[model samples]
Target: MILSQKLFVATLTAMFTFFILPLFFVEENANDYFIGFVVSSVTIPFIFTFGLLTSMLIGNFCHKYHLKKIISFLLHIVSGVICLMIFAVYIFITGGSPEGYIQTGLMIALLCITVFFYIDIVMKKKSK
Candidate 1:
C-alpha cells in the first residue's frame, strides 16, 4: 500500500487501540465510568481525525516548499511533544489518578513513534 494509506490505517488503529480500548478496560465507578468512557470514545475520533488531517496538510506544505526533511523532522518533534502533553492532560482531567495512566502514557509514546515514522516516510517520498 502507499505510504499515505499506511499512515491512515496506522492513525486509525492507534486511535482505537490507544484511546478507545482503554475506556473498556479501565476500572472506575460503573455508571460514571461508563458515561466518561462513552464521552471519551466519541470525542477521541474527532481529535485523531483532526490530527491526521493536519498532518496531511503539513506533508503537502513540506512538499510544496521542498523542505520535507526539515519540516518532517520538526513536525515529528512537535507532534511527539504534543502527544506527551495530551497524556499529561488526560491524567490530570481523569481525577489525577487514573488506574491506567501509565499505560496511557506508554500508548501516547507509541503514537509519537508512529507519527515519527509517518513523517520519515513523507520526507523520503518527497526526496525521491
Candidate 2:
C-alpha cells in the first residue's frame, strides 16, 4: 500500500507539473486541457493523506483510552460523521458535490476498523 501510495502521489505530481503548470504560461491553450481531469486528480492526494492520518489518529486514540473493539468501532463512526460536517461546509461554500468526500471518509474509516479487528483477532489467537 505504501508503494502504491507513493506511486499515486508521484504520478499526480508529474501530471500537475507537466500538464497543469503549462496552462499558466499559455492562457489561450487552456481549453486544450480538461479542467475536470485536473480538478479530480488533485483530490487523490488529499483523500489518501487524510485517510492515512485519520487512521493513525484513531489507532492512537484507541490505545490511549484502552478502548474495547466495539468502542473503537464507534469512534470510527464518529469520525466518519465528522466528514459529513465537512461535506455540509463544502456545499455551503463551494457549491460542488460532496459525495466523494463522504465516500472517501467512510471507506477509510471502514478500512481502519477492519484492520484493527483483524489484528485484534490475530493477537488473541497468538495468546491462545
Candidate 3:
C-alpha cells in the first residue's frame, strides 16, 4: 500500500479504537450518551478537518521556506500540547474526574504524537 494510504488507515483506526471506544466503556446515562455522541460526531470531524487544513498550510510553508526537520518536530510538539489542552477543557466541561481528565488528556497527547510521527515518516519517504 502507498504510505499515505496506510497512514490514513492507521489514523482512522486509532481514532476509532482509542477515542470512540472510551465513550462506549464509560457509564452510559442520558447526558453522557448525548455528550459522547455529540463529541464523537462533531468534535472528531472538526479536529480532523483542522488537522488537514494545518497540514496543507504546513506543506505550503515547507515548499516556500524549506523548513528543517527540527522545525517540524517543534511544530508537532506544540500541536500535541495544544490538543492536550483542548482535551482537558472537554473533560472539564463534561464533569469528568481529575484523574480521568488527566489520563484522557495524556492519551490524546500520545495519539497526537503518534500521528505526527506517522506523518513525518510518510513525508520523509516522499522527500526521499
Q: Model 1: per-residue lDDT, tens digit, 51-103?
A: 56666666677778888465665775566556557756776797786456556
For each candidate, what is the lDDT?
Answer: 0.60, 0.55, 0.62
Off by over 4 Å in 3: 1-38, 90-99, 123-128
Question: Roughly what TM-score does model 1 have, to 2 decimal places?
Answer: 0.47
Any residue pairs clashing in model 2, and if so which? none
Q: Pick the candidate with the highest TM-score.
A: 3
**Range of the 10 consecutive residues with the lowest summed lDDT in candidate 1:** 1-10
Sort every candidate by TM-score, greatest first: 3, 1, 2
Predicted candidate 3 versus true structure: per-residue lDDT over 20-126, tens digit per residue: 55653557578877776786686667666665555556555766799976675566566666666776777778887556656665666566656655665665587
lDDT of 2 by residue, 1-128 (tens): 43344344344444444453443335455554576357547645554465446645776787788887677667656765665566557665887776665665456445544554455445445657
Task: Between candidates 2 and 3, name the one with more favorable TM-score.
Answer: 3
Model 1 misplacement above 4 A: 1-7, 11-47, 97-107, 110-112, 115-128
TM-score per prediction, in order, is 0.47, 0.44, 0.54
Q: How would you order the candidates by lDDT, starting with the best?
A: 3, 1, 2
- Look at candidate 3 and tell me the lDDT of residue 98: 56
